[model samples]
Target: MNPILQTTINKAKTIPISEERKAILQEFIQYIQQKVDAGKTVNLNFICTHNSRRSQFSQIWAQTAADLNGIEAACFSGGVEVTEFNERAVNSIKRAGFRVTKNGLENPKYFIFHSDDSEPIVAFSKIFDDSANAPTGFAAIMTCSHADENCPFIPGAEARIPVRYEDPKAFDGTPEESEKYDERSLQIASEMFYVFSKIKK
Candidate 1:
């Protein structure tokens, strides 16, 4: 396993993490680990209204969870509108102990923190980068409702899954906002682990 992934797994140990979350993580780890063990490359595109909070969290944690489980898969994201990636989301990932780096020619330098030998989350434009964002066959995972309804056809998705998440942005500026965001992040992380855990070998 990669050192960064080990770091993430260690961090995954903190915060009195729940049994449900652990089960989900373990399941996800088991499933995706099988895929990687078979030498397959899984491509996931996590989407939302903006390429900001909820989708970002899903992308990060899903990829991290995959890595922690020893899966060799990549993650990407996009938005209905070109909203900037949330700084808070990035900060949360960093605080969770993953190393982040920037890479982009024009769009937001898709920040990536390597946890495995998988490709980083590349900054891909919704209007362009069809190859990277959509590819020939990929999963269009709707992490929010707006992206799902607005983008009825994702041009190249082999499958579309609604993994909706509560918008932490809703709690913005409130006293519980930070807690809410962290909670939201944890929830997505937990679920991604669960889904990947069931991936067919």
Candidate 2:
């Protein structure tokens, strides 16, 4: 891993997750463990109303946690509608210790790297069932309540799990924007670390 990201992961592991939150995360952890024991590939698709903020963070952090824990898992993110991945969210992730490279103008593709040894995660904003995503045998992790409540069904998803997070979009142009974005990113990273840490080898 990139030294900075390794440091970020170390810090994330130390964050205190409340009991209530842990209980909620336990369900997802159990799902992952069951799938692994059954020898099935574990794919997680984090979905939100827009592939901008919360879902993006979830996908990246989950993948990072999986890599760190030696879990065979693929992570992806999508939205109900197609829009460019918000730049603010991208910047927030950079603040969390990723080195990012960008391509394209409209709906730009972001190649995020945590380590030189691994392939970069290719990210862009798109609808949940975009061609880049797995067609089946993946869990649809709802990262925003709006997407979860609005999209009643996700075809090809083995599981539709709602793991909602508050949108930092509310602070978009405010003075608290950077602070809130970093806070949200850390919260997701911490939960992902906790979830993967519970997996039995």
Per residue, candidate 2 scores C-alpha lDDT tens digits across 58-80 of: 98999888887899999999999
- Model 1 lDDT, full chain set: 0.66
The TM-score of candidate 2 is 0.97
The residue-by-residue lDDT of candidate 1 on 10-59, one tens digit each, is 54445464675465355334534554676767767888877788877887
Give per-candidate clash totals.
2, 0
User: How many Å off is the CA of 24 in candidate 1?
Assistant: 13
C-alpha lDDT of all candidate models, in order: 0.66, 0.90
Q: RMSD per prediction, one decimal?
A: 4.8, 1.0
Off by over 4 Å in 2: none
In model 1, the Cα lDDT at residue 170 comes to: 85
